[model samples]
Target: MSTATVASAPPAPRVQKRGTPLAKKRQWRAAYLFVIPFFVVFITMLIVPLFYSGYLSFFATRLVGGTSFVGFDNYVKTFTDPLFLAGVGRTGLFLLVQVPIMLGLALFFALALDSGRVRGSKVLRLLIFIPYAIPGVVATLMWGYLYGQDFGPIVQVLSALGLGSPNLLSDSNVLGSMMNIVTWEFVGYNMIIMYSALRSIPAELYEAAEIDGASQLRVAWSIKIPAIRPAILLTVIFSIIGSFQLFNEPSLLRNIAPNAISTSYTPNFYAYNLAFVSQNVNYAAAVAFILGIVIMIVSYVVQLSTQRRERLG
Candidate 1:
């Protein structure tokens, strides 16, 4: 008699094949195809130059045959350079004072626009945002001329009134002057962003607040501000980064106020001068990297502090 034998089921299908050279090769080919352009441009423009800068930073450039390795000498020189240190300090000061004021103005304007009480709101918004639409160079040039001591109508009018116009291009007033220009350019830009966020908020919340007899101010404080906190945070982060990366306005203004604004007025300006004007590409790279790191750290700190406050509340 033959024994009854049960047929065994075939093994379950493998979802991922292991040790398959053909699959591996196909995957590699796909990856390469997907990344070819990025690698090409990145290597050509960014990666190769970055590595070269890193290598160069170890050496001091010479007017003669070749450069010699000095090992952190460039970095040491950066810290000890009074001009560099002063630029850093001035940049930090702008970030601290101007960023907050600009963001606050943006927030206030956004809230006002969102309130729906103001007639001709669209026109007002457009007018406010027009400055941002202007090219930075053009805007700076126009404002620079307007701040001119001799040619400016403002100074002329003030003189006629026997009230001396403050020298906006002076060393003491240059920072404030720059701040005003930046605020004018960016307030409406940031306001538009915050307004979009405010519009996204659910109307039901406001309706409920009104039902509870909350005033407009109370609704704004208790609901609108809290609801749009993320957008506010985003604008603050962007403003902080922009403040640190300031160059064009200061650079253009430098020509007008060379005595007050040095070749290194802002970190970006300093880096630019180092790389191009002075031909110290290595030191410029170091300073560029340092500025990037500083901005990152400050952004992170702002996020942390805001998060802590939210948690506490």
Candidate 2:
């Protein structure tokens, strides 16, 4: 019998001691080096601006007084100003209607694509996501042209069918029209978020569901939906934030639907006009702070509700 001996491995190197003053100094320096840039940018871009805006919010800038601290008078005016109030109401309406529809379509598409039953899902996903890839300006312009009252392809097509072309840019219809455009623009973005969440779910869960003879719909509702609730909530919060910050689409569409989209059509629009057009930077700052508070409150409520439900589950 041949005797075989295994070679013993060399001892591993000792980890370098970290608590020595020089070592700690090096570590601290490295940490500072890494974080300094971040602090610089944050202070310059965010902290300074936010504090300045907050400071301005407390004062009112008038032609007679120049700049005077009025102590929440600007805030009070923000709540009372008819145009600002109307903008807030319009934004709320958009949020209530558009967010649900956008998230629903995104969820449906995500679920359908994740299901093994769908064929050519890659192609479909690419097609769906193409709109998101298009620049917001370009997408709005393309849709605006298509919605044109005179000689646009859609209008011409309707005319050929002997049906009068519906004015999508009309005051009564513009809000709904904007909803459709926004949904088309963002559904795929939300879908990507949801699909990624769906993919993270364990295959073991699906296998167990199948073994229990659960149908596709049953598995989706009882397992898939619950597993992806966080992602859905994430999309909902994002939609809420985006809905309130509504600017690009409305701003671009204003040219096409000036009557439908007034200067103060949305809070963001109102703020922009106040700051730049009307030269009311102080009041604009107040309006912006008010909107920020609303956003923060809504986001906190959503997160709190989600956490409570998760604990219950």
What TM-score would candidate 2 get against the native? Answer: 0.89
Candidate 1: segments with Cα more than 4 A from true spot: 1-48
lDDT of 2: 0.89
Structural similarity to truth (TM-score) of each candidate: 0.85, 0.89
Q: Candidate 2 lDDT, tens digit per residue, 49-156?
A: 999999988887787868887998899999999999999899899999999999999999999999967899999998988899999889889988988888678788
Per-residue lDDT of candidate 1, residues 81-116 (tens digit): 788888888988998899899989988988999999
Q: After superposing candidate 2, which stretches have Cα over 4 Å from the reference?
A: 1-32
Model 2: which residue pairs collide?
Answer: none
